[model samples]
Target: MSVAKKLASQTAVYGVSSIVGRVLTYLLVPIYTGAFAAAEYGVVTGLYAYVSFLNVVFTYGMETTYFRFANRLGTDRRELYDRVLSLLLVSTAGLTALLMLLARPLLGLLEIPPGHEQYAVWVALILGLDALTAIPFARLRLENKARKFATIKLVGIVANVALNLFFIVLCPAVASGKWLPALQPLVTHLYDPTVGVGYVFLSNLFASALTLLLLWRELLDFRFRLNLAVLRPLLGYAYPLMLMGLAGMVNETLDRILLPKWLPDNFYPGQSSLTAVGIYGACYKLSIFMSLVIQAFRYAAEPFFFAQSTEKNSPATFAMILKWFTLCCAIIFVGISLNVEDFGQLFLRRPEYLQGLVVVPILLLANLFLGVYYNLSVWFKLTDRTYYGTYIGAGGAVLTIVLNFLLIPLLGYLGCAIATLACYFTMAILCWRLGERHFPVPYPALRLGLWLLLASGLVGLGWWVQLDGWWARHAWHAGLTVAFLVALYVVERPRTAAPLVVR
Candidate 1:
């Protein structure tokens, strides 16, 4: 019970940043959807999709490697940190430079507008800064410095949001002499209207740089060690994780990348492929609510899991965690998917963006499965059979690529949503099965499946029963959601009567 409370408390602290910062950042979705055309927003979407893949390459699984080795007996914690950060610094430098050097050609390949060549360069810098800070942030997690981590994360996000509003909203208004006429001259000198959506990337770059600056103490502590004895083991363990991460990013972001290429012209009837990409991308932000929950849990759970690896009761504790995690995610899946119309109208400012709302529920459920997979993945990591993760992730990535290729032209972005769902569902099931053999946990699979089924059934019921008036329809959905909570309480109430512990 105490352990669970500790995990929950840490999750809450991390949630302060992940949930709050994401919601703050999520607000920008509306601004972008309203401010730019779907095609223009597609540029932002496509570029960031590429950045996700590059991010995996930049850090190359060193963060988790640091946590693993740092906790191992007889390992020099300071030496581990130094070697990890040193490798990351050297790799990030070379990768960012190479990215910048090939920026134009890369943009050309992606079919980015010619004048927007700077996007690639800005993206490289952002990735480099983020990669460099990964170890510092990991150290904070390992040290149980949740408050500091949350504070730094929130500060960076606030800065990003403020800058975005400044460059994208305030500057445009001022330069046009609509608001702050007195500042028009200065704004005109500073803001380039031609930059347009480029300001989004610029705001992020500035924010990343700010984040790196704030982690100066961590950077200053680096002692620049090149001990191959220490590094060889770290790299050996991490290279597989890097492969896993690259493949995971493919499962996560490749749809956005492929949708622009594989989506046939005029599939949406009068909308270009890029416009479809923008619409899909905007609606995809709807999944961030669930993603934020998973991310917060992960921020707390990863290190917590490592620390608990030696406990006799760890497997049972993990099983208990998975049960509750799935239940919460299931509720979120239903709540968000059922009210997706309201959410779409609220966050997606333009009507065209709403055309992709059909994908929201699909995506929300997909993310739920992804979260489950994250929980099941502890076995491989703890057992040091991380190659299993590489295999599982690669299988999912291959599936994502194939499904996107085959379905994008036919079903449009709906195909991408389906592919994501299938990929995650398969991965979660596979991980559970594989974990049973190596690191058996008595997971309540049947109960968890039933919970999901009940949630899915309620959503299906909400969709079936048509009611007039938006408020009345929402009332029915609320009633259904409440019923699920009631059922959940009835089932888990007795379990809570005693502290969950190993006998």
Candidate 2:
């Protein structure tokens, strides 16, 4: 198979799982919004944002390090696997224990509600389990076990979704004697209505635990010994990645975390900061289509890039990948941004969440840029200049923080949406500029820029053109979306020409 074909096949498998699984989980938005108040859902949003941040800390970049070293010419892949797992096991244990021990203080620091002390412990366990399983999953990717990876991911997502429905929907009906009066006694034993939004965390914890259980055989091959020969280079490489991951999380998720704390009371006139957070968080799910694609591509691309680093045509392959990736993202950006209202109405059961729909397109565009940045970041990873990722990510994080702080007071979450777009767009540009100097790829800069410009114009047109009837509005927007794809196909039609290369 050609390199592109191989990557595409791998991405297809991963993307199917990611898209299917996330869409399944994404379906719970209506359950959450319908059953809980915005303030209640805000807790779910806030807690998971911390999980994203701590997940980086708990794993500390070993997954990527494992992939990098394992693919080296003469490395003992099994030994590397054991050593990496051992390292993660030890560190994860200590960190999880520390988190458990300091749960009360951490809760206070996070400004969590008084009675939800159990949330801290549940979150710590979830984090630790996820961290422990990180290497096993990474190993599967390195070995091209995409099917197994997808299976495990789907299983976990299914379990999570099932649990969510049970706790959030089924149990409530049973307890209320509305749907299944016969199950009331059994449901009461299992479900506490007061737990409320806590079920979201509980569902995740159970899913992570189940995933770890499924990966037990992968862990059985491990022996708890850390060789400094491996440890030195791995840590040397990984610490910077960890830093980059942390900063990247800041750019990605810190807005959700800070939006509640930083925004003034009554900023939205009768809406609390937490309520604003809930609404923004729910609307933010509207952008998951972009994140889903980026994540699936990252799964296939990272290991593929490293393994192909020595190939003569790898730069061309990388450039081709970015061009097509950005085009796909641009299409998605326009398609969803144009239909943001429909998505909001369909997914967000409550009307309050519709208020934050304004941020969805901005966020979709932001995530599209983020995917481009991921493709551009291969240069640093391939060249073993991972520290450059740290610098770029840290710069983006600073920009995100400063922008969020400055704009939250003025424009609320729209400011956050703006900051996210600016941060990721800047990072993508910076990565491209730096990559040209060190590991040049003949990226189709002009073509990709023009496509994005056209996509943006369509989105603007969708916004500006108001229709009296809903069907007319949608028909017009759908036609515009189709025109985007048709135009790209015409412009990018295949030709008998040599592929562009940097050298």
Candidate 3:
């Protein structure tokens, strides 16, 4: 098989774990929104925003560090894995204990209700378990155990979904009806309807615990070793990556965290801050189509980039991959944006939460930029200039904070969307410019710009042109989507001269 074909097959394998898993978990957005009020859902949204940041802290770049050492010349892969595993075990236990002990203070910082403090304990446990599992998962990837990697991920996601259904769906039915009267007391005792979003947290906790069982081999296989010789260099290589991950999380999730804190009373005087958070969070989930793509690409791209760095034609291959990645994202952006209502009907459960739908397209574009930035970021990682990643991510985080502070009060959730878009676009451009000076890939700038322009033009035309009937409107937008696809084909017509398989 050709190198390109092999790369694609591996990427597909990675996608099964990332894209499929995220889609399963993402399906819960509609269910949660439908079952709970916007305010109730907001509790889930806001708390998980903090989870994203804290997970970065708890994991502390051990996964990337593992990949780095395992791939390096003369490095003892087992020693490095065992050292990473040992370090994480210690750190995870300590962090979990600290967070649980200071639950009240942490809850207070988040403005969480006093009764909901159990959420803190649950989150701590979840983060700890997830952090402990990080190296195992990375080990699977490093060893080319993609099937095992995918199985574990799918198991977690499926377990989470099943648990969600049991707690959020069946428990409510058994509690309020006589259909399961024998188990009604048990259901009533375990599941409190008034607990609201706590079930979301509980489901996550249970699912994470279940995943640990599946990874027993990985967890138990490692020796307990944390040699200073290994630890020093690992930290040297990883600290900058940890900083990059933390700052990236800030840009990605700070809007959800800050939106409620900064929401103005005049915008919705009667509704609580959580209500605003719920709406924004639900709308943001609509951008998961883009997030899933970025995630799947990242999973496949990282190892591929590292392995290919030594090849003679690596730069040309990287450039080709970038263009193809751009094309995929452009197609996704156009498909999702032009067919916004189509997706809404499928996943958007509550009309109330759809108030922030305007942000969907904006956030899709933002996430696309974020994905492109990830592709550009290979230069820093490859050159051992990972600190440059820290700079770019930190700068984006600053822009994210400033923009959200200024815009959230004035524009509400829309401010959050705009801020995210600006942050990512600026970061992508900056990273590309910096990359040109350091470890450049000949990215087709004009071709990529035209692809984006075509998508934007289609979006604009769809918005401007009016159709009299609902059917007519969908038909028009659908036609525009087809036209975008055709434009893509025409632009890449030269490649199709030789069929992909030539069968």
Candidate 4:
């Protein structure tokens, strides 16, 4: 099959699980925001942000290392897999143990209340499990077992959502005598009236453990062999990748972690910083449509690009893929930006949390650039110029830090959103420029740029033509999205659609 067709097929399969899973997972946003106070939700968000950062440290760049080594000609695939898996198992276990031992000091460092320290422990466990499972999950991708991969991922997400609903929504009512008495005790203890945010992490830990069991086939395939020679080269390749991953993650998540500390004292007086963080985090979930698409694309794109590295016209093929990815992502950006008023209603059930709606568009645009950067980054990977990626990512991390430092105190969470967008946009552009020097792909730069400009215009028009009432506003915004898509299609019909017609 053509690379495009293969990517489409795999992405569709992956998307089924990703989109549905994220949609289901998104249901928990309402549950969380409604169940927890803003401060409580902020604690949940900050702790998870910390978890995301630690995950990068625990995995230590092994997932991509697997891809790099597994695809190389001279390597023993099974031994490489075993070594990487064993390394991950040891590292993650050690990290988790270390965290457990120092849990008190860590909680003290973060200044979380005694009651909420358990939340940190729950997050640490979940991240450890996720880190350990990363290789097995990557093995499924390497083997092209998209069906099994999608199934396991979907099931984990579904289990997470189910648990959240049972604990936060159903159990409370049942325990409060609003429902049947028969099931009350089953979850009465589980549904802690005061432990609102803790259950989110607890549910995630349960789901991660459940997912490990579901992936037992992949996990049990592990062996205990160590290849010293393989380890040297793999480490060399992955060491920079580790830096890239760390810098990249810090760029993506530092805001969530630092916003509370950085915010001005009077921004939301008398409330805990956790509340501000929670509002930002919950509202950010609205941008997950863009995130889900980008993530699924990355999963398919990385393997697909690696497999196609030796093909004729591979650079051109990659360029085409980037163009299509940008176009589709731009469409999504417009769709969401135009209809954000409706989408914001999904999680911002309270008036206090509605302030976070401003960050939605900023985050959505940042994710778009992040996706483009991922696509552009193939040049370094294909040409063994991975150091460029590290450099670009480091630059982005610096930008993220500087912007958050400057703006967070002045503008609060909005500064974080702006800084994130700026960081990603800079990273994407840098990657593209550096990739041109290393392995130039004939990206449809002019056309893709035009598409972005046109979409921006349409979004601007939607804002200009403000309609009254929810139904009217939704209809108008939907119409704007459709019109923008049709215009984009018309402009690119010859290049994108004519060949299909001729075929």
lDDT string, candidate 1, 350-424, tens digits? 899998998998899999999999999999999999999999999999999999999998999999999999999
lDDT of 3 by residue, 1-503 (tens): 85566677777887887888888888888788789988888878888898999999998777877777788899888888888889889989999999999888877766776987899999999999898888898888888788888889899989999889888888988888846877897987788887777888889998899888899998789899877775998899888989999999999999998887898875866678888888888889989988888877777778778888888878777777777888898888888988787677677788887777888988999999998999889888889898998999999999999999999999999999999999999999999999989986777877687778879888878877879898999899999999988877875877744322110
Residues forming the 10-long window of minimal summed lDDT in candidate 4: 494-503
- Residue lDDT tens for model 4, 63-143: 888997789898787778889988788778889888877777766655586756677678778888898789998989999
Q: Candidate 4: deviation at residue 185, Å?
A: 3.4
TM-score of 3: 0.96
Q: Candidate 2 local accuracy as lDDT?
A: 0.92
Question: Per-residue lDDT for 86 in model 2?
Answer: 89
Better of 2 and 4 by TM-score: 2
Q: How does candidate 1 fare on TM-score?
A: 0.98
lDDT, candidate 2, 1-503, per-residue tens: 98999999999999989999999999999999999989889888888888899999999999889988998889999888988898888899999999998888767755776878899899999999999999999999998999999999999999999999999999998888899799888998999988888889899999999999999879887788877775998999999999999999999999998898789878999888889999999999999999999999999999999988999989888888998899899999999999999999999998888999999999999999999999999999989999999999999999999999999988999999999999999999999999999998999887788889999999999899888798899899999999998997777765314543322
Write out the backbone clash pairs for model 4: 38-275, 39-275, 42-278
Query: Candidate 2: TM-score?
Result: 0.98
Pairs that collide, model 3: none
lDDT of 4 at 274: 75
Q: What is the lDDT of residue 489 in candidate 2?
A: 74
Query: Which residue ranges in model 3 land beyond 4 Å of their true spot?
Result: 496-503
